[model samples]
Target: MGMGTTTIESAEVKAAVASLREKAPFVYGLTNYVAANLSANVLLALGAGPAIGSAPGWTGAFPAGAGAVWINGAALMSSVTPEALDEAAATAHRAGTPWVLDPVAIGAGAAEYDAILGALLKHKPSIIRGNASEIAALAGGAGGSGVDSTLDSSEVIDIIKGLATRLDAVVAVSGEVDYLCDSAGRATAVRGGDARMPQVTGTGCSLGALSAAFCAVVDPFTAAAAAHAAFAAAGERAGRRASGTGSFAVAFVDELSDL
Candidate 1:
């Protein structure tokens, strides 16, 4: 929290949104599955526009003129071919657009998977959001399952810290306690969320988009804080109202509106 920690005020959040709107309100999403739709909607709800597309072809141009870019590899490997990802990432990189990376199922082995990892390194994402396992794997700690983080947040602090420095980007790891780190070797842990959040499929993806939305408005650190705050508040609000994963989904959307 050292770098501009106290600067995350309401005015800052508002200014970020204003910048986003002026910049095109368009957040190009390079991802897979309905989660991509969910993430795009999340951005729209937060006063930004969303465009869900793959990491290739015309989708590559989508980020060239957007406020921010959010990438989630959840269903990517299954849907968008590796060639598509390569093209899209190149477009984003050349444009100098701030992009977020959600490395779903990272550390899983396959030629395409490895290729995606290499692409991420080349893209030099501004922000990388993943759960503990995914962050750990990205940082050379351990592999993770399909977006399901297997390690405790505290256990991966070192890896997160190291990765943030090495990548020169912000690294966010979600868990019981969420940690956000930057190249400065500083980190902040945010708490307060319903345990039921994990039961929902697209919560993490939604959070990633939210982060990009904030990034569109503010610096990386505060963007992370706003995202963390919004998600935690929404989760807590939805917890009491949700009876199960199904109900939680509805409640979570409602909570997003409330936030």
Candidate 2:
């Protein structure tokens, strides 16, 4: 029953998803500017409270009752400065609040982002999701510049395993197939999303937000799987009716709501 000891189960993953709908956990995000609106909308569709926190107001105080926090390392300092990012991470770490760290485009950035991400790494997140390149770079491996991935998901398995061990957190590797790797090196393949899923922006960002929502009520592994399940399921369904990227974008949110 203790955290990190329980084995992941399909039943538990489904249960976590069901619980989110009932609990409607409030998720606070310090995310990318480009993906902020879509992230909020996806969380809303999943029946989670979504709010974006910024500097000054959120500096001294965490939200009144946020169930979880999501720190997206995209468009750094969109509403929060690096100092504020540090403060929020420390706050969440101290409160034992679950948070997801989406290290978006940490690769090939300036040394400032490296430092900021390094600081947040001190406060362990419940789950960390990233593309192969992002996670590889964060782990000090060779990676692409910006959001592009030079490595496939499978190519970075060792990097993911090592990073999960180092961070003591669940790591989700996103690609055509998702691999949810735990600190213990346990890996689960979550396959459901369609190719169209990637055509829409913020799908990955929203997945991180959704993982934070699930983290509120479940262990990290299940929480990550639940996110993979919800997003991939919705994406697969949305792909059925959507003819283009524009239609899939709208229908993706609708499918998420229906899911």
TM-score of every prediction relative to native: 0.88, 0.92
Model 1 per-residue lDDT tens digits across residues 1-259: 3523312235654465466556646777767776776776677666788777663457677778877787777656558766666665667778987788888888865546845765667778888988888887777666776677778888887787788888889988889888888887667777778988877768888888888777776788668767876777677888888888889877877776655
The sequence of per-residue lDDT tens digits that candidate 2 reaches over residues 1-259 is: 1123222236776688679899998888888788889999999998899988675658436633578888888747465688767777778888888888988877676777876886789888889999888888888877567766777887877777778888899998888777778887677777777887766778889899999999888888888988887777788888899889999999889988886
Best by TM-score: 2
**How far is 168's C-alpha from truth in model 1 (Å)?**
0.6
Q: CA shift at 256, candidate 2, in angstroms?
A: 1.3
Native-to-model Cα distance after best TM-score fit, residue 233 in candidate 2, in Å: 1.2
Pairs that collide in candidate 2 are none
| Full-model lDDT, candidate 2 | 0.80
- Candidate 1 lDDT at 24 equals 41
Scanning candidate 1 in windows of ten residues, the lowest lDDT window is 1-10
Top candidate when judged by lDDT against the true structure: 2
